[model samples]
Target: MGSMAFSKGDRVVWNTPQGRTEGTVVERRTSDFQLDGQKFTASEEEPAYVVESASSSKRAAHKESTLTRRS
Candidate 1:
């Protein structure tokens, strides 16, 4: 991956099985943690983002590679 170019509250979009989903970056996960019983490993070099879905209002964690900054 490249560098961590996103910050909290940034609007971003990502692809899902249903379609493209838009959301706001809620947090940057730089350490390993568990969400909904699933374990996630994050680091300063390859951080994951916690985003809140615009439509569903649900939160999900995604790697930086899966997200795109919304314009």
Candidate 2:
């Protein structure tokens, strides 16, 4: 796959304009999809993740490379 080894409910962190943010992995999207009116490209080799922000509970889709597994 595309190194998106995280499973659903896994705690993860990623960088954002506001700085590092933490959240839980809600789903792994392997096909192209739209979220929040934004397009996201994904594939079996380069998957995208639907993550729910721990602080705001806002959901956003992000490429696997942008996410880091957290404890």
Off by over 4 Å in 2: 1-4
- lDDT for 67 (candidate 1): 96
Global Cα lDDT for candidate 2: 0.91
> Which residue pairs does candidate 2 place in steric collision?
none
Residue 30 CA error for candidate 1 (Å)? 0.5
Q: Estimate each model's TM-score.
A: 0.92, 0.92
List where candidate 1 sits over 4 angstroms from the true fold.
1-4
Cα-based lDDT for every prediction: 0.92, 0.91
How high is the lDDT of residue 49 in model 1? 91
Model 2 TM-score relative to the real fold: 0.92
Q: After superposition, how far is residue 4 of candidate 2 from its true place, in Å?
A: 4.9
Clashing pairs in 1: none
